[model samples]
Target: MCFDAIDMRVFDELRKLEMFFKEETRRGCSIIDLYELVQHAGNILPRLYLLCTVGSVYIKSKEAPAKDVLKDLVEMCRGIQHPVRGLFLRSYLSQVSRDKLPDIGSEYEGDADTVMDAVEFVLQNFTEMNKLWVRMQHQGPAREKEKREKGRSELRDLVGKNLHVLSQIEGVDLDMYKDTVLPRVLEQVVNCKDELAQFYLMDCIIQVFPDEYHLQTLEVLLGACPQLQPSVDIKTVLSRLMERLSNYAASSAEVLPEFLQVEAFSKLNNVIGKVIEAQVDMPIFGAVTLYSSLLTFTLHVHPDRLDYADQVLGACVKKLSSKGKLEDSRATKQIVALLSAPLEKYNDVVTALKLSNYHHVMEYLDNETNKIMATVIIQSIMKNNTRISTADKVEALFELITGLIKDLDGNHEEVDEDDFKEEQNSVARLIQMLHNDDPVEMYKIICTVRRQFMTGGPKRLPFTIPPLVFSSLKLVRRLQGQDEGQDENPFGDESLTTPKKIFQLLNQTIEVLSTVPAPELALQLYLQCAEAANDSDLEPVAYEFFTQAYILYEEEVSDSKAQVTALHLIIGTLRRMHVFGVENRDTLTHKATGYSAKLLKKPDQCRAVYSCAHLFWVDDQDNMKDGERVLICLKRALRIANAAQQMSNATRGILFLREGEPQVTAAAIQSLIELINTEMQSDSSTPDPAADAFFASTLRYIQFQKQKGGAIGERVYVLMFLGKRNVENLSAYWFTTKSFTTNLMV
Candidate 1:
């Protein structure tokens, strides 16, 4: 380690100190070893440290080899072959070469201070040392000798230079090895005694390294100011520096990597935590700006940190929702508009809430409900396939609905069902909008999510209000202008786009749910391991979900229908769940052996469940496809519904299940069948959904009959056939002939 010009000046000044140490040593070894140590340390100190560290800065290039100046060391080097001599010899050689040594003992700790004092003493030796230090700096360090000295300009230059280099190296596999460079920079940034050194090194680091490096640095920053850790003034200064770092990265996003941008967001969270630690309520604006910049950086990074990013953004949505709720119309509008836009664009909201001042976002961003809607949309997106877990998405949605129900405490008249129904439709559209990419497990998740809304409520009969709550029957009324609800139907007018948030949230949630590996893991483990188990020896955990759906139909037919409609959900979910593996064929068996008898019984249940599991098939013609599939499911549901109603004990659960599936085909079929039966003046034990399902299935059967040239009265049941058509709704004939041709005389 050779000295730079300034370092050499320090040494030259130390040479002058040679006279002082020599002059003082002969005076009487006043401080004992201090005098002897000083005598030897003059050369040893710089040789070990300043030379080892700052010395590297003076090198013109990395290619240079060591320039050994001492000839007398040759004999000592040769004699180092001796064991004891080698130990002292190696230490002496290292001490002489770089003048820097590790902390070998308490003596080393005591002497390091002597090195700094030595450095200071040399600085005081000549006014020239000051000039030399300035010369070494591109522009002089900040002139505060008593405290932190900074050189923002030089630091900025280093950042720009490396930042450029990193950009150029974006995806390049430059063989440039930097494994040690970051740690070196870390120490330099953390431990720079000189304020100027500290500031410049950090500035250089933030600028030069890629965004990933910044994120890496932030993880270390978590260690910066631990809650109960002992720290020094350096720690204090470093913490302040961190306050500015995210903002600095935020300044020019091109230098920020997605990972760094994400970490900057996390940093905002950390900052919030810090504020809590400090017990500071109502943080300042610069802090807000810093947090906002992190958001700005994230939008630039795109989908990379979206999951963690959503956590931060979600806090704001909650805030804006509150503001919207308090009837702060402006806040409601702003929050809604912000939420309505693509989340990738909302920097302000992101920043404002990153620190967790959720109350403000709620109060200031938008109406609480609207904001909640936005949160649901966004969080739903995050909780969607790509962002989170099925169970989590389910839990999140359930939590969301529960929260809304808790908030809607006012006593409105019975007419307000429109409002409740409208909310339900919004939820319905969100649920129904599930695409092929959506996981089948999501059905169970959705069921589980809205299970609370399916029944239980404080105002209504246990859970009855939930069914009414999600039912869109009243909402369709409101859409026709029959009632003035707080919100409008999102799907009524083609001219009006779906709330961007609603759709995006759906998209995102699907995206997140798609990423959940655990369910997939469970699936994989079940699929692979269950194949090896004997049906009689298997435990329910081995593949319970796989077999659960089958038990419904079999049990419904045999007469133990505890719930009428629940079997439909189990079946629907099974159909959807089987999709991702529709092409895979495996031996139907338990996933594990040596299970409880309760789990292994009903061996046929597994085959029954899987047989209908592949029912909900999603294809390009999504609407038509869903309708067709749903129609079929309705028929299947009719059997279950009929079984439940007939069993007498099944009505309770069927009632619960009915509200959950507002669009159940069996329900619609039953509606049509009841109308038909009234016209026919027929008496029956009760409305049979299985019969309704048969009635609905015959729509296609009638079409098939027509294709085969059969007459109206030539089918299986003449009374069930359409003999004449009547267009009851005046608006119907103008739109389509189907309703006009099929509405009467069955």
Candidate 2:
């Protein structure tokens, strides 16, 4: 290590030197006066230190002798033979001269020879520093290896400063970098044969040079990989270089064609190829790691180039398969992850790559062990294909899906369903984008997906078919307005230019999925399709699907709970039907209400019938000012409620009476009180004949309820208690009106 634990006495001396120079420079001492002070200082090390300090003052003053002062200081630095002291003295020299050193092409600074001398000066200091750094490791006790390494880490930047200064040179073009700079730097890296030095120096080289210079001299840079110490990680160096090149591709994408050119990947491949072959006994994992990093870079730079990625991955798959190096599970896992990296990073480009090279790579990875990688590849491919929204791409998507499922053990049957759910979603997204404004194209893509499902066999269809159907239905609703009862014309409207074709595709999906084993799935999909059809105003199609659901419920569906749900779905669909004329809607409403009445459980029948009763009476829309049918529905609902109540099923009966009982009893008493009060208060000299008759009818009903004397009697008494004062006046008025009518009749 260049740095050591400084004795207190030595620290005090260095501190005094630092302070004296600081004070002297602040006092505006002439550079000549400072320079002569170095000459007069007796000892060699102190003289060199004072010379370097005064040299900085000279350079800052812009004096002519600053160069002379720097040159003389470098010459005098050789006097310190002790490694630790010499390294620190050189570090001090590099720091002081860093800014003042002549940069290339600077008219005020020195010429090329003078600049080279400065670089050489820093390089010579670095070489000696490294030698000293390595020699310090053995000087201490063998047990001190841990402690020695700690000290060496602190002082590593001292040696690295030379490389930093070299990179900082201005106007050093490709020729200079390739001819003069690189050879000299590589000489040091090669001669050291030390892992730490080689790794650190190589990393500095990768970072400090311009990417174009690396591009021009990629061979030289990569050629040094094989010469590195065995412990050196060549991947780090290669990875940094590749990153620089990829950024070059990004920043220069508009102007330069070099990075995007096909030959770029080949060049990268060549460099990595040499790196692998150079080391005869390189661990297969190590070689795989390099190629993996290179593949990622290839994708990043040429993301639009399918062939380049294919070529790179083809080599990787070949190497892994031919060598049989994927022995352990961990290594195989790593390789799988590495090969999957390009898909994760460049998802948008995967579809194009799939069109060209994905299948070739899949052919090699076509086994059960590589199922995860295959899945990852297919998922990325499908995602991009969907985003592009071209119908022609649908066939390729299914092909990839088929391949992925085939790779799964027993065609994905043995795998957990969760694993295939994401792929299914991707297919759904494809269906979503598959529809553009063209309905015929939409039909073609949907039919293609349906056929693929049929070809894939029936076992997985129930799980996978719903998304396709759902996506199709969603496509329809989005094209047309989602509301079912709207008056907007969907057939010729520009918003949904082809509503008929969307309807046809939906029907086609339903017809295809009807034969699957999962009847519950069929029921759910049919219900969805019917509602979507209603929303689009395809009422006849909606009725057709509704009928299909009823058939499923009656025949295939055995679960009582499922049957209840299906019945509710039928009623709900029927209720949304406003486009059908009065006669048609009334007929459908009657059918739904009848189905609700026929439910097995008495409570379900009560609830379903009561809910269906609302469909017969639409407020303000029914022109016939008659409550005859409403009364009929009320009577049937009352009967069902009575049946449920007689069964002594507390939970079941409460479901009906939650609203029905209070409404029925409240209406009977409230109507009588309201009619009697209104007819008596009007002193119109002539009584309305209709009000007379209505008053008679309500009084008769309440009188009947009062006579029954049970729960009904209690409700009637409660109603009468609230209107008792009004009831007395109403009874007197009713008797008088009745007597007056009788006299008139006589």
Candidate whose TM-score is highest? 2
TM-score of each: 0.26, 0.62
Residue 713's lDDT within candidate 1 is: 21
The worst-scoring run of ten residues by lDDT in candidate 2 lies at 714-723
The digit string of per-residue lDDT tens for model 1 on 455-484 reads: 324332222322222222222222232222
Q: Which ranges of candidate 1 are over 4 A from the true structure? A: 1-204, 210-396, 401-425, 431-746
- What lDDT is reached at residue 104 by model 1? 24
Candidate 2 residue runs with Cα over 4 Å from true position: 1-86, 96-113, 135-147, 170-174, 248-266, 279-304, 319-392, 395-407, 410-430, 436-441, 451-463, 471-518, 527-548, 571-597, 607-638, 648-746
Model 2 clashing-pair count: 0
* Candidate 2 lDDT over residue span 1-746, tens digit each: 13444433454575577567768867887667777877788787777777777776676666664456666777778788775677788777887787777666643265323666656666676777777766666767999987877777677777888888877877466797888788878888888887777888898888877788777777777777778876777767887788788778768666247564435667778877776767656677777677767877777776776677677767777666666535556455556656566667666532444644454444444355455555565566556663534456766655545654333435544656776565455444445545555555665666677777666456556655776787667667666653344234332233433555555555556556666666677877877777777667776666666667767767787777777777776766565555556665666777777877778886667557655654654443454222455455555755675565446422111111111343545555465466446434545323444434444544565466557753422211111111224334334432542112221110
Task: Assess the local accuracy of residue 580 in candidate 2 as a C-alpha lDDT between 0 and 100.
Answer: 58
